[model samples]
Target chain A: MIPLSDVTPSALNNVTTQFILLHMARANKEPGLGAATCLALVADETAAVHFQFWGSECDSFRPGDIIRLTNGIFSYSGNRNALVLRAGKRGRIEKVGEFTMNYVETPNISEIKWVPEGASGRYVPESVVSPYSRIFPPLR
Target chain B: MAENLLRPQPYLAENPLERTLRESFDTNRRILDPPFPLSIPTPEEYLCLTRAILYSILTEGRTRGIRLKYLHAIVVDGYASFTALTASVVDELFERLLDDAKEQIVWIAGEMVEVGAQGFGDLLVSLLRQVVGGDYGDGNMWLCFEEASLFLRKWSALLEEDGEGRSALCCGFYCFLRLLGDHCRTRWSGDERLSALRQLEIDFCTKMLKEQFSLCMNVGRDLIRMLQDLVHVPEFHEIWKDLVLNPGAFGCPLFSDISQIYRIRTPSRYFLLRLTPEMERQMRFLLTNLKLGGQKRHQAWFWNKFLGTNPERETLVIDLIRFVCCAHHPTKEVLHSDIIPRWAVIGWLLKCCRKNYVEANAKLALFYDWLFFDERVDKVMNIEPALLLMVCSLPQYVAITDSLLEFLLLLVDNYDVDRMALITRGVLTSFDVLTRSGVVPSSDALTSAEGISPPLKERLGALLLRKEDHSAEAHAID
Candidate 1:
């Protein structure tokens, strides 16, 4: 698994990694969908990012589960309207361990306000809107 | 420009956590109006953003001045409209777009339809279909009947117009009412959420029909057509049963008679063809109650007078005409439905054509069902012009009857006859058509007026001569 710090905004394709979910918020329904989704904060010792869980995924994983993601996407999802690392269609995730790894939960990738402007005209984090998940208020 | 100075620029810096909280705080303060000057989603930029919209999506302050509150409305409208022709690339971004679209789509549609914007009208129609189609769950679809009724009231002129737009609206209204009836009739348990959803939709359906129907004449007519169409559906029969059997379930749809001959249209023949036994039973119940004799009080509040002096009584009869006509045009539907008794329609025609007497009607107003009894109903150029216009606009079958002759002759008794000006332009045209069509005898047109007072004889006699002269001119010209 890649170190969470290496999973940068520049990492666009084939972002596979493993992390412990430090905390998760409740599932929410966005405007169009008939189903609810959840947004949470996950971390590895080196860095942290926001993660979205859809359908059964919401219930399958919990705050302490150390999960593995294969071919996952780190992009915008749900009402949070921010980038989140998620097990998108080509991606598969399974619980490999629980609370055994060191992790950090700051600078949620979802909190970063991304805009399409770079030297290459690709999505770049123009500003960081928040350092943590708003829904899953940072565990004090 | 001064207001821009006050809006915090927390979004510009690389601090996502502070920005998210601040956005929520902004939303809560109700300071959500989109400051458009700052809002911009560049097409080439939006195209790039459209693919993922995840990392590319902007936060509250980031997306070129788009306010989430209004964006919510835009989204609801988009959700409701089946006709939203989306570009192929815009697909993936919708889930991302949902955050912005999270509000009710109520008023936007009425405004859109009013402005005659095509895409928005489809949204309103879709919103209607969503509720009626039961495509929503968990009370999420708050079918604002008030808005839907307002939609008809607001967009009617355009909806009634002839074109692709008109046809789409026609189909929209047709499907909407039919689906609404089905929605109301469906069974649901009284769980708080489900019950509220059911009740709101039902209330909207009832109000569109009852309270607000008469707000505009064309809207009222269109609503009637929808209800008539609704009753024909087996699934919709319950709403029909409610209207025809439960007096309270129905409302007086006619508020004014300014609806000239121009307003009447050929009503659907569907209900007429299949007037089932159950339908026949309910219509009879409606007719029996509609008879003005028994229903003088519950139908009105401030005005308690019966058909003679009561505004409610008069309005009830007028609404009764519209209500039944909604089932089918009064003339043709009468052949099937008992809701409109022939005698009552004739009685109404005569009542409408009541001759006006200025001094008599004014003085008679004070005695209005009080200690005194008086109804010197007549036309003195102070005619019951509402009744006159209504009488003139009836189906040609009703307008050409011998009963109409009796209605007009009732005015011949008072010979201060002002034969020069008609109450309205259409009234004169209708009268001329009736005369030329032989419904009114051409020869000695006022022969019966010879024995009236001198002024009456002179005026009536001159009108008779003018009619003959006009007939001669018609042959010479046309």
Candidate 2:
């Protein structure tokens, strides 16, 4: 398990973390695939991220729900052109608690631009696309 | 593969308490037969059996008789562990339980009360906390009915059962009196079930007040506040007359005057009687942890969950303010930090009131301590928020400051005509201590603010000046 701030852009589906759901967007259905997905803003004490909910997950959680993701992944989506945190096929998510955790909206991991370091091929922050989430602004 | 105890929400982790009970039941299912082991079990084995039996009582409806029989036979610790587990289940799993499980819990409570189990009072208090203040829904009303019936049926047992006997009823007394304030409202008088429940609550409250006046007195000043709401009800009207006119009617020797009730500050625990556990948790988190500007989302979530469902729930704002002002006190660190202060939350709650009466009641709850505040008895924190709210709201919201000051002045005169002097002294002392103690820098924020209306200022000045004249006379005499 790791804090949300430690999550980096990775395809290997091994990010385990917990956060409170802050804002959720409307569910959208694919034109041909008929699969539904919703984007949500979730944050732990350290940082915030854009979390994509697939299928049944879209309606299962609401704002103020504290969710724990097991073996989750943080990577860019092919269609949306934005990075997101998700529990894709080999991962899981569960509601653990609610309304008790602290959070920070700045340093949204999803909005940062990551670049591959020299030959080690590890992702590192190259530039800031935005300080906080552009899609879901912080609640004043 | 086994029967579950709680209704499973998607993506929600199973509560460990429920999980342990379910596991105990499953692991011991085959052995729960006629030839129950005759040997006395070890303490650990005793806990396991108790957990399994409780789980079966809630879930295995067909074999509940056998489970109860086994439980009665093996009771060595005064049913302490069993009742503790039952209380925990009620606290943690009551809202998420299946409908049958909910019924089973109430029935089990009846069993606990029937047998005079240890710690049964806490179980009853936990159940009472689940009775929401402004809720008029069928499920909420049903719990009210069942719990009220349980109290009425076992009244004698509750009075004489154990060491926890009277105190538990005291909790029930506080709960029902507070609840009756909502139940007796006219808008919901048409509902048959609510009407029945209201009658039962009146019967129980009147029985306690008439038969056990001292016990009712244990609930302190909030009892007056609760009964004040019920003055229009015929039965409570008679009680009110006795309270105001004939203090001897109550028959409690220590109770001489109504001011005695006013003098005792309502304990913080009694203030918690109205809030559900979840609401209490969220409010505590918001006040203790969240910063000023960052509380918007949390506040929205709280309102959406607790208040958005019913218009009647706006009535709960009054109780929430009382809980915040009296029950929850922040430490000096959080108080001095940028954490959202209690007064801001009260100010927000004051704004949330949609009805005029509720708004008035919320403000009254905010400043109830001020009317009867005695520095020797009452903690300064209880009166701190109203003063800070008045001072803090001066810059951006002069209306909040204006209305609060006006309300304080009005309450001093109108709250109790006969005891106007006492009420005046209470308000005067509240302002003096808050300033002298440095809770606020000075009263100048209110008295000398340019934005405040002159008429309200004149009244405030007169009230404060009157106190000084008396003090000066004492000095001159000395």
Candidate 3:
């Protein structure tokens, strides 16, 4: 089992690896049953699958935490990419000590960007380029 | 580790989730980049959207404004939407924000009054049709009626000077009156709460009619003429009676004039009795001008000729009463009760029954015969619950259990036992205590003569005890 951080997206393209991360995702209790944690994660470079942990595994993981996994199987469940890890493979999993979750945070245009001194536009001139430019760079 | 980790090198990822998110961002970018597209909408466009939402809500359709609480929030926060605010939301917001400030209410009132009568009239007519035609349930009907009534009331007050406004107001008032009449005739039945609401409607119509009498009389004569066609409708009779009897409630002088006009032209004795003093004077004045003799002579002649000798007029009054009171056709014995005269009881029962049913007419005739003729007649005999039975049934009567009870009691008294078992079971279900007492007179008399009295009471008592036990068990479980 390769460590998740060491497994690059390209290497994950068609290869299966066991990964355990604190599978941080929205958790909801199933009707008349135990809690479930839903995690959206990439299994390989070409595909991403969501993994759901039920019962004890759901309780064992915390969001925004890292755990290592061994023998995690990959499959697509409905529209989501998924990983399934069983208790027999629990010993292979380890919580990584250092990991930081990444969130997309766009700066407020009015606050972060400065327009040229002589700029004239309908909106208050901010140095920040349009969010569109950041989303889709010029073809060149 | 600290410097490199804190200032991590940027990495690029190509993945489906990231791709979708990236695409979404691209779309937002495209939407925003163009001409820095003006976020501010034109005033006209904004007004149009608000109007659309207002119309949707008013017409009982779904609105985004309601789902999002956009209307309430916008009004509360004083946030200007791209469109003008809907009248309904504005009204609601005003009530909340200004707490019914007289000045704001007046401004709203002015705006409502300015709306074209044609548009307002169409809206009111459509609403009235829905309510009267039973297109909506009671709660929705109440809401629609309330909104239309309040709107018209305010508009009427503010735009009395405008001919179009006055006409629209009258049209709306007429529709409401018709709705009330229909409610009384069809849906209300023995529902006391609804009956009370109908009474309030009557009061409202009376008030509106008084305030807009001339306009109503002018436009209303035509409307009344049309309504006259529905006079045979039970609802029409109910509302018409209220309108006639309580002319002052409408605050309309023209109602009196119209009432007198209806009296002279139609010579309905019911309408004649409902005339106010002013109406009487107006009729006399009109008659005098027409050389039908001076006011007093015409009045005496009118009363003597139409009121005194006109059996048809009397019959009409009796019919109106019969139509109004008896939920079921009154038995002859009930019609003869000393507390109410035979004619009056027959009239009341006629009013109570649905207008178009053949059974209603048949029942009315039966009641008439029972009231006016000797009780010994076969049809009338045994038609009333024995005095003791009636007394025993008084509590149920006051409770207004169901119309079936009244019908059963009347039928049982008349010795119609073909369905006695069914009636007995219904009574048992409705009044456990009374059923257990085993004191239903007609049934008791029949059973006693058959020599099954003691056993019958025991059976009844046992059945009631079992039922009570079951009920207790159910209650405990609940």
Best by TM-score: 2
Judged by whole-model lDDT over C-alpha atoms, candidate 3 comes out at 0.35
lDDT tens digits, residues A30-91, model 2? 67646798999999999999999999999999999999999999998747467999999999
Task: List candidate 3 segments past 4 Å from native.
Answer: A1-140, B1-122, B134-136, B148-161, B222-478
lDDT of 3 by residue, B400-454 (tens): 2122234334543442243333333323333333333442433343222323235
TM-score of chain B of 3: 0.31
Number of backbone clashes in candidate 1? 18
Candidate 1 lDDT tens digits, A20-105: 77667888877686666887888776767877787778777766567888788876655337667887777778786443455555
Give the CAPRI class of candidate 1: incorrect
- In terms of lDDT, the poorest run of 10 residues in model 3 chain A is A102-111
> How does each model score on lDDT?
0.42, 0.88, 0.35
Q: How is the predicted docking of candidate 2 categorized under the CAPRI scheme?
A: high
Residue-level lDDT of model 2, residues B114-147, one tens digit each, is 8898988888888999998888887889998999
Q: What is the lDDT of residue B78 in candidate 3?
A: 29
> Which 10 consecutive positions of candidate 1 chain B have the poorest summed lDDT?
B365-374
